[model samples]
Target: MAGILIIAHAPLATALRECIAHIYGGCPARIGALDVLPDSDPVEVVAQATAEIERLREDNGALVLTDMFGATPSNIAARLATVPQVRVLAGVNLPMLVRAVCYRTTSLDMLVEKALAGASKGIQAIGPGTPAPEYGCSPTPCAEAAADAAEQAAAGATDNVKAASGLSAGVLKPAGAT
Candidate 1:
């Protein structure tokens, strides 16, 4: 019965809400988004998000996630943090949003931690040598091959002097060239 509030810049809030709905299935009644309405003032947006937070708290405590620290949305969330049953986390990412939706019923403190952890885990590198392939096949060579092809193409198209000097075509200054 608890809620998760998402506050982001204009236009982004709606997209994020849809993404949350897609990932978590059927939008949550308690969930709220700021900046969706036309010409919405920051204070009004905060109040609206806060209203939802209060509602959720009456039902069960709520967790609020904002897109950036010290931004309007996060500032409002910070104000709400003083409330006894509310918790706020800034720098919200897709992973944190999804985790919050999935664990909406969790304790406020635990949900905050889980959302932070989800955000952190979502940023990990997905390149080769990162356990991406079961057989441990390296992807470095593939990247190097692409780079080599690009270099070869550049070398073939440019003058030898430019190539020798490590400068792209049309990049040399007459005064600087010997």
Candidate 2:
């Protein structure tokens, strides 16, 4: 499995890790997160990130996820691009991180593809007629089923939830699921 590192501004990195832990019942192995504080030293942060990457990287190398392009975190992450087998992706989000974690066991190149795809697909504009409590109504069963069907159709015609979520068969389970 490739190592996965999340580098972002203060609190976001740690929070994303915590959220993953919640989703998967626990944070999976070969994962590390570093929060870059406003007052942090760039040199020291780079050293720390390199160490973490070395420690976490396995046969598949590592994937570094950062917040924004041209920011401190991305700049720090960019430094790792020269490292053999490492890829840096900016604009980290929950869906992107989840997809990366789910697909970490794949080849490094495949993992990058999955992460970028997840980042794009996770974004959606909720418009009128979508059943959401925020919109003040539950979706009818038919509407929900249609939505599920459409989503599955969009997921490369895969019916398996795990496949759609970028997980291998029988690999991961949410917290408290049997």
Candidate 3:
């Protein structure tokens, strides 16, 4: 079994662990959240989280999940990435946490993929189109609704990517839109 660690700004780590427990029951021997203060030195906090991570690694190879890419938690995790037994992922969310706990026995690479996929799926919007066809929804109309919903989702995803890449949504000229 793989060991999991979560390091995040403030109380995010604790909240995420609670969410995982709620979704899949409690995880045995997993470490979540380093005890630190807002005014605590960054290096000290990192060192604390790292120590816990190392301890968990003794039992099994460990995966560290953090809240943001360049934030303190992730930066601390990055420093420990040189350890062959430790792998780190940023942008940890409830879905990713749940998936990690669910697939704790899987290989590291597969677990990372599952966590990423779960994070992506977690952000999706649920509407009338997402319900099952057996819920008194007609097949043909349901198909059309699903297609429309998917198209909207794609558009939203593209907009988010563009925004993250520092491109203004209005700056991108659609091929067929004026």
Candidate 4:
């Protein structure tokens, strides 16, 4: 199984871990969370993070998740990319973390794909008019709605690309005033 490390601003990393624990009823092995404090020294943080990476790494390698790109945690995570078998992904969210934890037994590359899918699939517009199923209120119904939404989103993206490139199989709109 691949190891997972979460590096984020103070408290976010630890909070995410705790949330995962809450969901899973227990914290899984080979997972570490590092909270970077405001007054943290980058060099020391790197050292500490490197040590965590070493401890978490296995045959399948380790995955590092950070809160935001271009931030301190992600910058620190960037330094660890040179470490063999470690992949760093920015924009850490609950869905992404859960996916990474659940698929820890898979190959590192496949785990990355699963994590990315989980992150994107987890995002939705929830409002008054949105269906409860799409809001993930129930397991089976939510899964079905989510699957249908994913399919539609994919097809819509394809159509959008085609239209943008003037290759759509439909009448092209003439440039005109709104």
Top-lDDT candidate index: 2
The 10-residue segment with the lowest total lDDT in model 2: 138-147
**Native-to-model Cα distance after best TM-score fit, residue 72 in candidate 3, in Å:** 1.5
- lDDT tens digits by residue: candidate 1, 1-178: 3577777777676777887566434565667776544465767766787677776663457787788798776777788888777788889888777656544444567567767877886677777666765556433221322343357556674443223222232111122222
lDDT of 2 by residue, 1-178 (tens): 6888999999999999999898887888878999999999999999999999999898878999999999999999999999999999999998788878766655688779878878886777798875667657433322332344457567666454323333343234455533
Per-residue CA lDDT of model 3 for 91-121, tens digit only, reads 9888677666544544577668767877776
- TM-scores for the candidates: 0.65, 0.77, 0.67, 0.76
Note the clash tally of each candidate: 0, 0, 0, 0
CA lDDT for candidate 1: 0.62
By TM-score, the best candidate is: 2
Candidate with better lDDT, 1 vs 3: 3
Candidate 3 residue spans exceeding 4 A from truth: 35-37, 58-60, 127-178
Could you tell which candidate, 2 or 3, scores higher by TM-score?
2
Error of 2 at 152 (Å): 18
Local distance difference test values of all predictions, in order: 0.62, 0.78, 0.62, 0.76
Per-residue C-alpha lDDT of model 4 across residues 24-119, encoded as one tens digit per residue: 556767889999999999999999999999999987899999999999999999999999899999999988887777556556887798788778
Clashes of 3: 0
- Segments of candidate 4 deviating more than 4 angstroms: 134-178
